[model samples]
Target: MKSKGFTLIELVVVIVILGILAATAVPKFINLQRDARIASLDGFVGALKAANSIVMSKATIVGIKSAKVETNIPNTDLYVLDGHMSIKPEHIKAAMNIEGFMVTNYALTMTRTTFVYLADKELTMPELRALNCFIHLTRSYTQQDGSNVIDTGDLKVNEFYDGC
Candidate 1:
């Protein structure tokens, strides 16, 4: 007479296989969040670079000497200054899908010779959210003697967006 289930080795082998599969699959899933964050950061950097190029190019013709970029309060889209431009949040949203994806919280400082932009992004799980962006502007003036001087240090960022 033989009993039905006396196979400890079989159970152990099954458990080992399961563990191996889990070990391999878990890491890939966990890494997805990190990839999303990197993508978001890249997009932001690209947009900032684009805007900087635009400002520098147009300044000479517009007599903009120096200017700061601003946005509507409590939002990322709808830029104001010279004209309005639309910024699509979808790219960011797709990457992070954070709770509050509409607002931007970062700061910017600019001069005819230099411009600085910074963002305080809060990461949740795999998502990133921005707080605010402030900007400052300075102007450069050239003298007939071929001397260049930088003037006007008015660092102002118009009200726009809430910290979500």
Candidate 2:
């Protein structure tokens, strides 16, 4: 009588095929987290722009145009520099959800304000920036003759996610 069981070679071939399929798929799965982080950063940039728009509209309505004037959006503890939406944590948090995010550094003056991110709160700003996974937002006043302030609302945004 002929045996019905499969030969060892057939089983080994099946296992080899499965191994090849796994090898092809593993890398994609491994990069999902990175992709997600990068996408989130994109969304974050959009939110920042929206917040700035809101602040600008409020500033116009409130007539907060003086270069030395503090940005005052009523009913929020948030503040900006020179009537522009600053990169302050409080100012940003007012517009979007930043549950797990942490700010590494923030500085503000009458002429400019900057906000830098620490991808991880435990990591130093330099470490996070070296990984190319940080955001740097700056709002500054523009000068016409390198002396006279012409515009008080220019925002510069720099975001990186190569090492997300």
Candidate 3:
């Protein structure tokens, strides 16, 4: 008699192989989310830098305030472009809604400077532990020594903290 269809054993074997392949592939797909997060962060950093430079040169302090999502992109606000720069507002929204970003001020000058320190909202406890992931940007610059410089202002990405 000729076999009419795949045997039970053969079908079982095929199912096992498919299961193994799926098991291996699922984790990789899950990890992709983390990669996306890193990419978004990188983009945000670049945008912030661009915005800072533009505000420092061509715009005023009010220009920096327009760096929010609502001012630029409505609703989702994943990206905010203004002052000759585009920033990912979604990062800030994520940080705000998810508590993933924490803004800290590095007082280089006894008073507040034009730049604000931005970083991952969720940092390790003790504050000092998370001090490394800081990004600095100056929206305002003063002319000193016949040049425009942040001088007492700077931005940190915290990723470069402790030689990271």
Candidate 4:
């Protein structure tokens, strides 16, 4: 009699094909998490740049040369650009916009002439954490032509791809 269903050989072949497809697809899905984290970090850097520019423009308009400014937050001080209020870690946390991220640390050194924002704890992946992935925003003030000027050195991202 003619067979009514797939032969054992055919079934085995189909199963093997499926397994191959899964092997390839699984890796793609796994990489998505790493890509997502990288994208988030890039977005944060962009936001920081925009915020800094806005603050600087405002400060220039107001002729303020200091990096200290009064912010909307009561009892808290923030950096200033040109006279405009600049953003700080506290503001970012209060916004609660970024998921799985925190402002890990903030410090001023060199007699309060340098400011640093550290966001490291956001990287939750074991590999990334082991790599010590972090983001840094540093600003230094300098005396130029008898006026204090703010110099944003760079936004740094420390991420090792192997960890991701």
lDDT of 3 by residue, 1-164 (tens): 99889999999999999999999999898677555555655666675565456443433344443442224323333333333332233434332342344444444552222222234444433463444333443333356686544322334344423311
lDDT per residue as tens, model 2, 26-138? 99987997777767777777877777677777667766644354565667655555656666666677655665565534333444444444344546555765777766666
Error of 2 at 19 (Å): 1.2
Query: Which prediction has more favorable TM-score, 1 or 2?
Result: 2
Instruction: Give residue 43's error in model 4 in angstroms.
Output: 1.0
lDDT by candidate, in order shown: 0.39, 0.65, 0.44, 0.51
Model 1 lowest lDDT segment of ten:
155-164
Please give the clash total of every predicted structure, in order.
Answer: 15, 0, 14, 3
Q: Report the number of the highest-TM-score candidate.
A: 2
How many clashes show up in model 1? 15
Write one digit per residue (lDDT tens) for candidate 1, span 1-164.
Answer: 78798599999999999999999999998677555554544454455445545543444344443333433322232232323221223322322333422333233332232212233443332242243222222333334555544333322333212221
Tell me the deviation in Å of residue 16 in model 3: 1.2
Q: Whose lDDT is higher: candidate 2's or candidate 4's? A: 2
> TM per model?
0.36, 0.72, 0.44, 0.59
CA RMSD, predictions in order: 11.2, 3.7, 9.6, 6.0
Off by more than 4 A, model 4: 1-3, 68-78, 81-88, 94-96, 106-131, 140-162
